[model samples]
Target: KRRLEDGEDVLISGFGKFCVKEKKVRKGRNPSTGEVMMLDKRRVVTFKCSGKLKKKINGK
Candidate 1:
């Protein structure tokens, strides 16, 4: 959490990596009412599994 807050990527050996990403604000529409709206920008955390971990999980 702290690493993510600091915009740093964290990696766990034999596991995966966590990184922070910035999302830009954009226009959106409501599905039900068809009303146009502006989506707020925000930071998001993403994770990608290590190749070794993926192989292990797949029983390879």
Candidate 2:
């Protein structure tokens, strides 16, 4: 949210508010009951790499 507000898309690996998203809902199965269930959408934190970081990893 901060990043978006700042008009920045790049983010580091460890810490930042931009490294998150609202996960979408989907169908899933319960392991214990072997029954189908609807999974609710929720916000989740995630990590994404910048182009510079990707280049460094590939170069190595």
Candidate 2 lDDT over residue span 1-60, tens digit each? 666545455455543335446679999999999999999997665666666667787895
Error of 2 at 16 (Å): 9.0
Can you give the TM-score per candidate against the true fold?
Answer: 0.86, 0.54
> What C-alpha root-mean-square deviation, in Å, does candidate 2 show against the real structure?
5.3
Local accuracy of candidate 1 as per-residue lDDT tens digits, 1-60: 798899999999989999899999999999999999999999999999999999999999
TM-score for candidate 2, please give it. 0.54
Tell me how far the alpha carbon of residue 23 in candidate 2 is from the true structure, in angstroms, after superposition: 2.1
Task: Estimate the lDDT of model 1.
Answer: 0.95
- Which residue pairs show backbone clashes in model 1? none
Clashes of each: 0, 0
RMSD of each: 1.2, 5.3
**Clash count, candidate 1:** 0
Off by more than 4 A, model 2:
1-10, 13-18
Go through the candidates in order and give each one's C-alpha lDDT. 0.95, 0.66
